[model samples]
Target: MIPTNRQITPETPLDSLTLDELDQLLSEKLVTLQVDLLKTYEQQLREHEETLDHLHRHRRAISLPPRPTIGQDDWHSYVYDTRPSREIASVTDLVTINFTNVHTVVDIFPVALDNIHAIYKLDSGNGYILQDDTMHLLTVRNQWTKSPTGCSCPGQASDTRCACCALGSVLCQVSASGVSNTCVEDSQINSHTCSSQSPRSLELDNAIAFEYHTYSEGVQQVVVIAKGENIHFYRLDKWGLQDFHSLKGHNTINLDSPVTHLGYGEMFVEQFGTVTRKRYLFTFGLDSSSKRYYEIVTNPQDFSIETGLSMMWDTTGTSMKVWQNGGRVIIGVQDGTNLNIHELTSDRWGRQQISLQQVLSLPAGVTSWRSYATGFENFLIATTLPLPALYLTVATIDRFLQTQRNIPRNKLQLVGVTAMFIASKYEEMYCPEIGDFAYITDKAYSKAEIRKMEVTMLNELGFNVSYPLPFHFLRRNSKAGSVDASQHTLAKYLMELCLPEYSMCHYKSSIIAASALCLSLKLLDGNNWSDTLTYYSRYTEEQLLPVMCKMASVVVKSSSAKQQAVRQKYKASKLMKISEIPQLKSKLINTLAEKSASYA
Candidate 1:
C-alpha cells in the first residue's frame, strides 16, 4: 500500500507522483473532509437539543395567576369607573358652569366642611366652590370679570369696559347674555348645605401675585398660600380651616418680589439618641432680576425662616422639585437657552449650599422648558406602558456601557434584555414570564441564564429601574396641541426612532416630542405650530429646528438594515405604515439638513 516511487525522498513533488499514488492521496483527503463535516453537524444538533430542553424547563417553571376582573381594588375601580350611577348630562353641565371663564384652573383642593364635602377651585384672580358629591358650584362675593373684550365690575348690568380691572374673579356664568345665579340651584343654598359652611376667598390685602402649596402628615393637613411679601399657613381638620398662621417678611429679609414657587419637604432628625420627623417649607422669590431661596422650619412650636442662604444667584430659577422626601432638591435654572441643575444639600439646620450638579444644554432645536417637561412626562408614561419600559431599559444599559468602557460588546444585548425584564416587572400589571422573553430571543438565552443575568443587572443599576420615556411626553404634548391622530402616530414613530440613538438621551423628553411633532406636522402638511401650541409646549420654531434635524437623521438611520425593531414595528398597517413613508422621510431629512446648516 505504501508507494516507494523509485526511491523517492521527501523532496519529491506531488505532481511528479504516479497515477495510483495521486488516486490514493485524493481518496484520503475526501475521507477526512466527510468526518469533519459530520462532527460539525453533530455539534449543531446537540446545541439545538439543549435549547429545546431549556425552553421546555422554562415553560414548566412559569406559573402566572389568573387575571383579576374590574372593581377588584382601587386601581381597577379607577380605571373602570365603578362608582355609583349619576346623570352624565348633569355632571357635564355642572363642570361647564364651574370652569366657565376660568382661563386656567391652576389648583384644586378638597376638604370636608362639617358633614359636607367641598372642593376649592383656585383660578388666576377668582375662586369658586363646588359640592364634591352633587357637583354644584357655590357663589361667593368680590368676584370680578376679565373677559377678552373688557373687565366688568360687580353687579354691573352692562360691560364696564375698564382696562385696569383685576384679572382674578369668580368663574363666569355659562350663558353669554349676562351673569346670573341660575348656575347653582336656589333650593340648595336656601337649605344651608352644611351648618359650618362659610364663604372663603383666596384674596389677600394688597396682594399683587399669589401661589398655593399644600402638605399632609397622617390626618393633619396644612395649606400654605404665598401672597406678595407674606406667606400664610392654614391647618385643616375633618371640618376644614382649623387655624391660620402668617409669616410676614421684614426689610432685612426682603421678600419684596412675588413668590414664584413653593415646596414642602420632610427630613428625619437624629439627635439625642432618637429620630424625629421635621417638616420644612422652601420658597423661591424673583425680585426684579434677582433670584432668592428661603428655607423655613415649620415644626417645633416656634417656626423660624433661615435667611443665611438668601443670597441671589446669577441664573433665574425656572422650576424646582423636592425628591427623596426632601433630602434632595433638584433646581432647574435658565442659563441663556440651556437648563442647568443645581443640587442642594439638606440637613436639620436647613439647606447648606447650592452646588452645580449638571448642565443640560438645549440641544440645538429645543427650548429648556420643553426639554425639562419631557423628562418628567417620560417618567409618568414609564409607570404604565411596557414599550416605554423597554426603551428605558435599553437606554440605561447603553448609559452603563458608556461609563464602564471595558464591558464586552457581546454582553450588551443580554444586559438590555435583563433591563427590560426588570422594567416590565416594575411597570406592568402582568409582566411577561421568563420563558416568554426567552421565546422572543429564539431561545438564545435559557431561563436559568436570564434569571442569573437579572440579578447581575439589578446589582449594577443599584436596583433603580424606574425612568421616563419620550412616549409619555409625546402623548401629552400631542393631546395638549390638539394634534390629529394620524399626525400623533407619525410623531410617535419619529420619537421611537430617536430611542436607539444613545446620544439623543442628552435632550429632554419634551424637546424630543416637540421636535418630532414639528417634523411630523411639516411632513403631513398639516396646521403649523400655533400660539396655543407655543404656549403649551413653550417652544418656538427656531428652537425646534435644530432638534428636528437631529431627529430626521435618526429616522433615516433607523430605516437602515442595522436598526430594524422600531422601523418594523411601525411598518404594520395598524401603525399607519409610518416606517414605509419614503417620500416623507426623504423630505424631512433634506429640509432638516438645510435648516440645520443654515442655523449653524
Candidate 2:
C-alpha cells in the first residue's frame, strides 16, 4: 500500500542521509504517483462505459423504422404517367376555337370525356369553364355572415371558414353567462359570427407562367405561378385559383435581375444507406456581371434554399436542365450560343461537386430536317394520321440497309423516300397520288418505276407499317407541362437535329422527347420540369442527364456540311433565328473536353 500523505524530500538533511535511504524515498514517491494515476484511469473508464451504455439504451428505445426499398419500380410508380389512353379513330374533322375577347390567356384546363366535352379558360380576373352547352362564370368574393347555414355566395363552401366577430354587444352578454358555460356559450356565439373569405383574383397581366401540379394528397391539384420575383401556388377546384401558400420565408428568392426561367423537379439522394427525396425549384436570371442559378427546396414539409450548391455561371443562361439522377446539369447560355454541360458527382469525401463537362455550339437549322420529314410522313399517314407509321417507315429503311450488304450507299435516300410513300398509302386518309410523290422527288424516278418500288418495299416490310415516333410524345409532354411555345419549338428543332445521326436511332420517342425538352428549356431559360412534368414525362432528371449531354455533344459537331439542311432552315427569322445563334469559343470547348475526359 502507498502512503496517502508523504513528502519525498531531504527533510532529514540530504548530506546526512545515506544513498540507500534516498533511493528508498524516491521509489516510495514514484509508486504513490503510479497508483494515483491508475485509480483515476479506472474511474474514467467506468464513466465512459456508463455514458456509452446510456446512449445505446436511448438509441434502442427510439429506433428508426426500416428503410424503404428503392428500385426502378418505385421510381416508375412515383413518376407521373407518360402515356394516357385516348381514342385515335373516333374523331371527325378537327376544329379550332379562338377566344377573341380575351387579352392574355393565363391558363387552360381541358376536362376530357365529361358529360359534355368542356374546357376551362382563365383570363385576366375572370374564370370561365365552358362546355358544349353550358358556361359557368367564376368570381371572387369575401363576406361575413351571422348563421351556420349557407349564404348566397358564388364560391365553393369548403373554401370558406368560420371566424369570430369582434363587434360590440357580444362581449357583455358572454361575460353575463357563468364562466363555466362562458367557454361553451362563447364558442356558440363565435361560431354564429363566422366569416368566409374567398381567394383573391389573379392578375393575369403580371403572370409570366403558370403550371399545375398534384398536391401531396394526390387528389387535389395546385396551380403554381411565376409572377415578377415571387412564386404563388393556388388550390384549383370549381372555384379557380384558391390561395394556398405564397412559398416565401428563408427559401424566398429575391433576384437582382429579372427571373428569366423557372423549373421544378424532385431529387433523390442516398443518406446513410437510405433514399431521401426532396422537391426543388430552380431559377435562372442575369445578375450584375453574369447569370446566376438558384435552387430552393419546396417540399412544404421542409422548405429551404440550397445555397451551397447554387452558383453563378460565367455567361447569361437562357435555359437550364438537371438530369442523370442529379448527376448532370445542362445550361444553354446566350454567350455565343453556347451550351454548357456540367457533371455533378461526389468528391473523395462524398460531398457533391459540380464541374463543367462540355461546352458546345448550338447548331443552326434543325427545322428544315423536321419540316421535310414531317411533310413526307404526314402525307403517308393522312388517313389514320397514326404517329407509328412514321417510326415504321424509318425502321423499314434502317433494317433494309443493315441486312442488305449489297445495297449501294447512293440508294439510301431513295429507300427512305420509298418507305415514306409506302407508309403514307397504308396510314393516310387519302394517300397522296403517286404523281405527287414523284413531284416531291423532283421526278427522280419514272411513275411506273416508283410504283414498282413501293410494291417491293411493302413486300419487304411484311405489310406492317406501325411504330412509335417521338414527335407525338414530345408534343404531348410539352402541352401537359405547359412548356412555352418558343421553348417547345426549340425542343422540336433539337429533335430534328438528332434525325441524321444514326446513333440516335436506337432511342425511343419518349427518350428523345425527354432529352430534347431538357435541352430546349436550357436554351430558352425556362423551367426544366415540375413533379407533374416528371409524372407526365415518365422520366426523372437524373435518367435524362446522360442523354441530354449526348445531345449537346451532337449539336456541337452537327454544324458542319453534313447537316447543312437543318442548319440552313433555322437561319430564318420565322424560325426565330435558332440556327444562327453564336458558337462557343474553341478554348472553352477544349477546357470542357478535358473536364469531360477527367469525369469519365
Candidate 3:
C-alpha cells in the first residue's frame, strides 16, 4: 500500500520493514517532512544580513552547463521549472522532486534522527544526516548509467582517446550524474540492510571521513568509516548483512591518526583494465605545521611518505578536502567560512611496489622477443641454404626458445644464429662458415660464442632437431588438391600471416597448413575444404574452421595491429602481394570470423 504522512511518523518502526517494503513506500507514496529537521542549524542563517552576498558569490563561481535531457521526458516541464539560476539550484541530477510546498516533496526515506546536527552531501546520489547520538542513512533511488562522462574527443572515428580516457586529468568533466560509472545519479536508491556491524567503537564517535569501496568477490559492497585512529569497515553480502564483523581480523583497523581524506587506489598504468586493480589506498594528512602524504602499500606492508608544498602550515586546517583520483587538495581553517583556504598538491604519488605480471613474465618475454633473434639470424643463415633450411631455422629457433630458460636477450641471438648454423649443415650441401653467422649480427658475437651456443642449443633440444615445417604439410596438401600457382601462393601467404604471431605459435605444422588452405580457398571464393584436401590434411572442414576464422580476424586486424612485420614481408611482389589483396578485407571474410573465437 502507498503510505501517507498519517500512516508513518517520526516514531514509526522503519527498521522492522523489509528493504523492498521501504523502497515501495519511498518510491510510490507521498512523503511529509513535518519535522523541522534542518531548522535548528539554518533557521537563523537566512536572517543574517550577509547571506545574499554569500549566495551571489557562490552563484558566480559555478558555471552550469546546458541542461541535460534523457528519456522521453520534457526536461523543463518534468524535471525543471522555469526559475532563475540563483533561486533554484540544478538538483534534478542530484536529489529532490518539484516541491508541492516548502515543507513537503513527493518522496523521501527515513532514518531515526533524534537530534540532527548537520546534513552533508554524500557522493553517488546518497544522502545522510549527522546527529550527535545516532547515524541516519538515507537511501535514494538512482539508476546506474553506462552513459559515460563519455569521451572528451570530438567523437570521430579516427580520434584517439584523449588524456582523460588514458590518464585522468582535472579537465575531465565529472558530472554529478556520473564519474566513469562510479555511481552518481539524479535520484538513486542503494541502501540495503546488507550491512550490520559491531565494532570496537560502538558508535561512529568523532567520525571524520567516509568511503565506499568496490568489492569484487560477488555482488558484495564494502563501506569504510574513518574515525580518530581507527577505520571501521562494513560490507554487504549476496544474502545481505550476515556477520559483517565476522572476519578473523578486528572489525576496525587502527591507524596512526585521524584520516583527513581517503581515496580508492590509483595506479597510473597504461594498460587498460588495470587502474585500481593494484588497490593502493591514498591517505592525506594535513596539519598547520607540516603536511603529510601516505600511500598504503601492500607489498612492503608499510606506508611511504611524500613531500609536497606546505598547506596552511601555520594554522591547523579545520578540515581537508581532497578531490577524486589524484590532484590538488583544498584545505580550510574552518569548514564553513572557507577561511584560510589553501591548496595542497602532490607533485608525484609516493613510491609504490609494482607487481610482476605474475612470475611467468620472463618466459613469456623470451617467447615474444625471440622473433627478433630469428629475423637477424635468418639473414645470415637462410641466404645460401635451400628453402627447406629456412623452415628448419624457424623450427629450431622455436625449439630453443620454447624449451630453454634463463637465456639473456643478446644471448638469444647467439642461440638463433647457432640454430641456423645447424640447419645449414643439415640441409645445405655445405654449411656456411661459423664465422659468417657471427658477422651478420654486426659482429655482436664471436665465432667462438656461436660454436659454444650451437653445442648448447643441440644439448638443450636433446640432440633431436627433427621438427617438421608447415611447408612440408603444405606441399603434400597442395599436390593432392592440384592447387594452382595463385592458390598455392595464397595458401603459403596465410601460413606466413601467422608466423610472427606467438599466440598461434603452438599449432602443429599440419594444423597450420590445413587452416591456411581452408582460408585461401574461401578468400578466392572457391570451393573450400574439398574432399581430397581434407583427406590429405587429416583435418576435416569442422576442425579447420576455427583456425581459418582466426586467420581472417588476423588479416582484418593487420592494418592496425602493432605487429606488422609478417604483413610487410609478404607485401613484396615475389610473395604474391597476398597481404595487400583487397579480398583479404572483404565483409564475407569478416563475417565468417565473427563466430565463437575461443577455439583451443
Q: Give each model's whole-structure lDDT.
A: 0.49, 0.46, 0.46
Off by more than 4 A, model 3: 1-386, 561-565
**TM-score leader:** 3
The numbered model that scores best in lDDT is 1
For model 2, how does the per-residue alpha-carbon lDDT over 1-600 read when each residue is reduced to its tens digit? 324454445456766556776687767677676656645754665565456556745975795654333211111111001111111112224455665544433334322222323223343434455544445553322211122122222233452222222222122122222111111123434533322232244532112222223344433433334444554444445434344323333423455555544443443444333334443444554443224444343333322123335555454343443332221233222232333445443332324444675543333200000000111011001121133445556767776666566766766557766776776666555454554444334334545667676777667757666655777788788888888776776776777777767867777778888878876775566365568778998998777766666566666776664545556546645567776654322343234334433323
lDDT at position 304, candidate 1: 20
Task: Please report the TM-score between candidate 3 and the true structure.
Answer: 0.36
| Model 1, span 318-407: residue lDDT tens | 444332212334454443323455555544343355577654332111111211121111110011124566567666776566556775
Candidate 3 lDDT (Cα, 0 to 1): 0.46
How far out, in Å, is residue 588 in model 3?
A: 3.3
Using all chains and alpha carbons, the TM-scores for the candidates as numbered come to 0.35, 0.33, 0.36
> Worst ten-residue run, lDDT, model 3?
363-372
Angstrom error at residue 33, model 3: 99
State the lDDT of candidate 3 residue by residue for 1-600, as single tens digits. Answer: 433434655577988666766786675442222223223323443343245445656975898765433211111110101111112223136442332212311112221122332333222223344343433443221112212234444444343332122112122223332222222222322322111111112223222222223333222333344444555544322211112222233344555555544333333321221213223333434432223333332222111112222222333323332222121123322221112333333222333332111111010011000000111111000122344666788789887888776788868778777877898788655455665565344346766688788888899988997878888998999889888777888888777667666767788889988888877877786676898887778999899877787777777777898655556555645557777888888886788667627664
